[model samples]
Target: MNVVLSAVSGISASLGEDAVVGITIVILVFLFSMQRFGTDKVGLSFAPILILWFALISGIGLYNLVKHDIGVLRAFNPKCIYDYFKRNGFKQGWLSLGGIFLCITGSEAMFADLGHFNVRAIQISFSSVVFPAIVIAYIGEAAFLRKFPDKASNTFYACVPGHLYWPTFVIAILASIIASQSMVSGAFSIISQAQNLGCFPKVKVVHTSTKHKGQVYIPDINYMLMIACILVSAAFKTSTKMSHAYGIAVVCDMTITTFLVCFIMLVIWKKNIWLVALFLPFGCIELLYLSSQMTKFTKGGFVPLVLAFFLTALMGIWHYVQKERYMFELNNKISVESLGKLVNKENINRMPGIGVLYSELVQGIPPIFSHFIANIPSIHSVVVFVSIKAIPIATVALEERFLFRRMEPRGHNIFCCVLRHGYRDVLGDHEEFEFQLVHYLKEFITQETIMHEAEATTTTVEQITSIHIHTNENEVAHISHGYTIDDTLTKEGKHSSNGSSSGSITMLRVANSYSLSSSHMEGVEKEIKFIEKAMEKGVVHMLGEAEVVANPKSSIFNKIVINYVYSFLRKNFRQVDKVMAIPHNRLLKVGMTYEI
Candidate 1:
């Protein structure tokens, strides 16, 4: 931003320092305000401008290379670097590395954009276009610098031919803005992933492109970044000072990435240790750059370090609190038998509606459900425990998205559903989500009925009729045919023998006739009809609003994090119901308190 302002002030003599600052403020506001339109839309609009910028730089570099000393190409050789360090003192050469590190500042943006664009497209463009153009542009600048050492401070503008000066200046400003936009977009993507992984507080995420699930916009993050950038630009007021901060941040990012890649190769991929050691040279080079930048810590390099520490602390606190809350729920979850006993109590009422209870648990009843029943003494006639899980992938197939299981104590009409969504999958269409949930539930019931009937056909009528009767919902029931219904397999439809024998007598009669009877069909139809009627009554989205408080026995640090910082973030951030896009009128919030 400072560099662009300097160019602007250079073009117009009347534009003073204050005027340049005002211009920068306006540009930053405008840039961040455009984020709501999404990455795809923004990228399309900036594509032609960036292409022209790259082409112009490439042409200018090639022209200068042919016109000036071709000997600058020797800088590519490792021996030239060795001689330069020898010619110049070692300390001076080491410090100069901080300036050279700025060249790769925006390279990480490519990795950040993998979610928004295709990998093949990024690889092809970087290898064939971006990489070559950048190399040519740098060589051209160096060659021009060799001829006129006095213009080293502003080599980019100084190297431009007189006739094309204004055109290049305008394109340069636009390209810089596009670069800033890429970092902003990457921040949004990172925060979204963090929230999905429970490492960050929930924020309102808008899916900007219907066709691309990864194209998201978060208003809160955008405005925050805009303000931070404006403040930093205003403070530094010069590109040279800002360069120190930028160099350190980029080098640190590179070092971390190198470490992660080495770890992945050695551990996750199970590659040979020797192969992993190959990355050590690159890691050492990054460390050298990092150490050089560290010398400038008091001269603007502290900015990124401060910001990184604050963000890391914030994320660490939120994740810790979330993990503790999850542990509490996991330990306190009620068994299916206990839930059945509570539901069958005479005082408890099963209301006529379909209730979709949202939980983090994939199996067993979340403690929130029991808490809701304990206080309200009522539940929906048909209850579905829905857990939305984010799997490590780009996208999940539609057919394989929902996994359904019938909760035991079969006649209670309780089911457990695990909806598996890939990291890049969008789940904002409330109407479609509700429709699919019901559709899959009905499908699961039909499939299970058919499977059980098929199994019954192979069994003897005596074995089926003589099945031991067990009325207690809390105990395991032994079937005459070596089948046992254990209370542990709460996820029905997953195991055939885990099913109840409530309709076994009808199934046996139908099997004896060597055909499925309408009576047997009616039994399955009855359950489907009940579910449809519940849906007709209306679907209510039940979400647990947990108020987490620090345990009394916790230390001061834990209390400060949980009772203050974590609480503040949770209250201010977007709530789960809003994130899920549930209708306010149809939503049922179950409030509970947790001390953990």
Candidate 2:
């Protein structure tokens, strides 16, 4: 929005003010519309143009330095700065610092955009060109102002040579657009990180580039920013007033960043005390600038603080509620021992195929799983409880990604698999997860077979017969699901004379029970087959769609926070299923209400 205003003012100064507002609106609308298409196509174009703009400004500054007062070089001396401060005294000099702060208003944006490029690139660009160009341009403007005190108010335009005004105006507009892009990109990155960290609600995230994971577009955020930008531009109508609010925002951001850096140095890196102490002055400087800006509170500086308050409150409530919900799940979760006993009960039906139940709880059973089994009579032959956990790292290696634990030893057919992912890790689709899970199960079976061989244990005929019965149970489940069998299979007795699979289902059943060792092999093979069949039949994602409500006995504040504020946020935000990319066809949402 400020970009639009900057462009409009630059063009208006030379081309008159009649169409400036309309042109600004058109330019902004077009820029916002182009967001969906992404910046990949135009990102490269910006680099050269920005470089050219810097070069042109630097060149202009050099020309102006020689043409105007070369005495501006003296202003760079520390003695000159001290003399100016001494001349103005404490109160007046401090007030002047507020206006001086505007010179670096949007500088924080460079650091915010650090994710898009490596630190080396930023450092090189800043040191080699950007820093020097900016310094020269400011010096050139100051030199021009010194030469013509009457034209001090219009210094930038006045510094421009008559012949270069139109060209510089065009470049200035382009530069503003590029600057606007940086701001928009930085906001998207922050929102995306917030969502990943559970500090903000999940919105739709569209990857703008397959090659660049950092490039993203969020429609909701983009529109909101555009509307805010437009409103600010419309209301403020000039750069002077807008600078007050902008300076406050930038200074506050710097202050927050300084504190964060200090924390990382102290807690994360455990840096030397002297190294950490170096950051104290930076924090103080930022706080000083913030204090200076706050003096203009009545002149629109309070706008950023208000915006910050609302965003902070929203994020804080979300984080608090999420923590509370996790705590509740922890306190009320069903134990693994209890689940094992329930599965072993004679009344429970152990159906065929595998069931993958997604649970938030890393240990024990999620309450939703108990509710599901209670309501639905049939249970899968092999049930796996899957928990996805986010680790505080940039990436997790595949070798360390999955941690599998068996619920019970020897044929219990229940397991718990914990999947660990980093905040920036890419989770492959459901099919990939299923494939990896099955592959790991196969590895487990092979290792168990090797261990049994090493133990030199021999299975008895009764064990073989028990394995046969288990196979029959699976066949029974398959038949119940509308499968047909031949009449010859139906005619077979409890014990078959020959172990053959030619006749029907009954023959196939006895063929797998001929010998104790073969029975063990057959059982393992059947389990694998059952898992493969289940995969083909499709995976079902069972999620607890919980609604949080305040208990009637609670205080008014609690009621409002839970029932109104949290509820409203949950209603508007995308749910976990959508964020995790669960398929709609396979998703089974078990709705539940929780009173807190």
Candidate 3:
């Protein structure tokens, strides 16, 4: 942002420093205000402009390289770097690296944007367009600098031909804005991911594009980034100092990414140790760059450090408290048997509707459910424990997304469902999710009934024939709704040799006898009808509102974080119901306190 203002002031003699600052603030406000339109819309409009900008710069660089000293390309040689350090001394060269590092400052934005675009798209764009354009532009600038050393401070504008100066200036301004926009979008992506992973406080994340799941906009993050940029631009008031701050942040980011990649390679991928060890040299290079940027700490590098410290601390506190809260829930979770006993012994009223209990637990019942039941002495006729889980993948297949398990003591009509979504998956609205949930629930019940009937028939056949019949239980269990005795028996039973036809006929007759009873179909239909009736009564989304407090035995610091900082954040941030997109009319808040 400071760079944009500097470029503007460079082209306009009338605009003073204060005027430049005002223009920058206005530009930032406008830029951030436009974020609600979403990254896809913004990217669509900006893409052509950026492409043109890159092409223009590339053309200018090629022209300069051809017209001026081509020998400047020799700077690419390692010998030139070694000679420079040898001549200028290590101290000056080390400090100069701070400026050199600025060239790669915006590269981290690509990594941050991986959620928005596919790996192939990013790689193709960078390798074919961005990389070549940058290299040509840099070499062109160097050639122009070699001819007129005095213009080194502003090589970009100085290299532009006199006739195209104003046009180039306009393009430069737009390009800078687009660059900053990418960084802003990247911030939103990072924060949203962190929040999903329970590392950050819940914030309102609006899906901007219906077609692209990752195109999201966070009003809070946008405005915060805008204000921070404006303040930094105003405070620094010059590009040179901002460059120092920018270099440190970029290098630190690169170093962290390197470490993360190494971990993924060694642990997650289980790569050969030698192959993973190769990244150590690259890591060392990043550390060196980081160390060089540290020399500018007093100049401006401390800015990012301070911001990083605060953000890291905030995330740490939130994540720690969340983990503690999860542990408390896990430890105190109520068993299905216990819940059944409680309800039966207490004579708890079974309400008409289907109650969808939202929880973080995938297996056992959450403590909040028991708490709600104990307090109200009632529960919905058909209770569904729904836990939304985020898996570490791009997107899960729709068919494989929801896993349903019937809670034991089938009379309770309780079911546990886990909806697994990948990190980049977009959750549908309440109505769509509710529809899918109901469909899956009915399907689950149907399959379970058929499996039970099949097992019974298999037992009866064994008893009558006194002959062992081998069948794949899993094959029978997973049969679709169009249940047929022929299909089920064909896939399930293995007939004996001597009485093969007889055994097959016998098994078929026995299966037919069971099917003739219509018990399986009746049971399935009964459950389906019950669920439909419950739906008519309405589906209630029960969300737990956990009041987290630090344990009394905790240290002062823990108390301050949990009872004060974490509590404040939880209260202020968007609620879980809103994040989950639960319908307000159907939402039920179940309050529970956790001393963790």
Candidate 4:
């Protein structure tokens, strides 16, 4: 509504009101459509225009200061303000305070844009360009109001020099557009951060620039905001009505920020209690402003409160459901002892290539894997259990991302790879993840070979190599108190006198990708070549598709939360594959049902 009013007022004030509403809607749609292009290209174009705006307003204010009564300078005195407020008393002055609050409506953008611009840059801009310009502009308007007492209500437009009114109107419109862009961008950043930390449902995030790490475009949020703004503009159709809602939102935003900062000071920073006491006066001032705005509750002030409440409730539900689901998975996970026993069954067949299994469990194997093995006869030659874990920090270093653990004895080839990322970490493309996983696995295999060689120094090189080769194939599926991988090697698949294993070790083209550390590199290279061949065969992703439902005996509230709200949110959110950027062609999903 404020957007439409600003545009209509500018057009009516400058170009005459031929089709003000139509013009306003068209300009708004154009601005929103330009979001896809991003602000990187357009920001520089707006900067010079904003600079000229500040210069023109400041110049006009200086001119008015000289021409009109210089006594308006007395407003800087604290006693004058106190006396004026004292004369007006609580009832009248408190009501007028609502309009005064609108002056700082977009102040939240300063903190929101901290990620895009440095703190020092923001401080410099506010102190130099924004602060003085705002002060002079208001003082100049006050001077005009004092000189022409009848024009008190419309002093801003009436006082502008006749020839410069249209130019100022154009500049004002552009500034409003920039302000709207900042608000939209800030909303996107907050939503993205919330999604990362599991406080909000997953949505699509598209990085806009390769050079700028934080530049992002969220199409879902952009379209939603555009539609909302249009609806608001249509509904209110005037700034007078919209200002109430705008004031409520801004006041609540400031109040919440105040509380958050106070919490950080006391709990996070551990500032002395006396030092923190200084903020109490500031909090009281904000509370007074909030109390003044509350008087407009029936006049659109309730809109922002309703919106805030709904969003807060939704975020809370999402966080609760996510935590509950994770706990359920953890409690139901398959133990290593149970899985090892099943792996020993001779009837299970080992297929070619690698199967990458994604699970929430960090320690035990997911029960979904057990279900998959029970139903399917053939498992992969090498299986990788990948767990993507989110840490509390801002970002995890790339070198510390992948932590590899061999689940079984050396030759088994089954491994666990944990991918740890901080809340702000960017999860890059699938190709990069696969490349890193392969690199780390190769390094682990090299270390394992060196450690084995050091332990069995008395054994002949041929004996060690043959023992390693035999253990690799047999030990993977069998686990018991007295069983060893070497025991099953003599059962079958013995190499002929030609010193080559049977059909299992069929010759294949080897890619010279790995660099070995040991002098006896030939034997290790053979093992790596075999693993590379398996990789070339293909890599498949196994995703667990679990359906969450409420138990029959559960209360109505639990049923609604678990079976309705949770289900709806999950259906709307991005799926695991899309979030992780996994390829669809090689993916397999195993289904399970849970009653929680």
Question: How well does candidate 3 score on lDDT at residue 134?
Answer: 87
Better of 3 and 4 by lDDT: 3
What TM-score, computed on C-alpha atoms, does each candidate reach? 0.82, 0.80, 0.81, 0.82
Model 2 clash pairs? none
lDDT digits (tens) for residues 1-596 of candidate 4: 36446645654555554455556667678777887886676566778877988898888887787789778999898898678789999688888888899877776777766757889999999999988997898888888878898976556667789899888878877877877777777787788778877899888876555444355678888888888877776666666678899998888888877878888999999999888888867777888899999999999889889988989888998898788888888888877677676677798887888888998766667878878888896688888898886554445556445656677644657887777665456665776777677766765565455445544554332222212222333432111111111222233233233322333221211121122334545666676776787788888889988888888998898889888888999988788798778878878999887777
lDDT of 1 at 409: 92
Candidate 3 structure lDDT: 0.77
lDDT score at residue 106, model 1, on the 0-100 scale: 76
Rank candidates by lDDT, best first: 1, 3, 4, 2
lDDT of 1 by residue, 337-400 (tens): 8988888899899899999999888777888888898899989999999887665444655645
Quote model 1's TM-score. Answer: 0.82
By TM-score, is 2 or 3 better? 3
Question: What tens digits encode model 2's per-residue C-alpha lDDT throughout 574-593?
Answer: 87676668788767777666
- The regions of model 1 sitting more than 4 angstroms off are 1-14, 45-47, 63-79, 116-124, 207-213, 390-402, 419-443, 459-515, 532-538, 583-585
lDDT-better candidate, 1 vs 2? 1
Better of 2 and 4 by TM-score: 4
Model 3, range 1-596, lDDT digits (tens) per residue?
A: 65566556664446676777788788788889989988877787678887998898998898788888899877888899899999999988987887787887777778757767899999999999999998999888888887888988778888888887888888888887788777777788788888877999888777676556567789888888888988998898767778888888889988998999999999999999899889888889889888888998999889999999999999999999999999999999988778778768556998999999888876788898878987898899999988876554455556445667778688778888877665456674888888888987886676456455657656443433222122233422323222222332332223222212212222212323223135555666788899999888989999999899988998999899999999889888887587668778899899988998
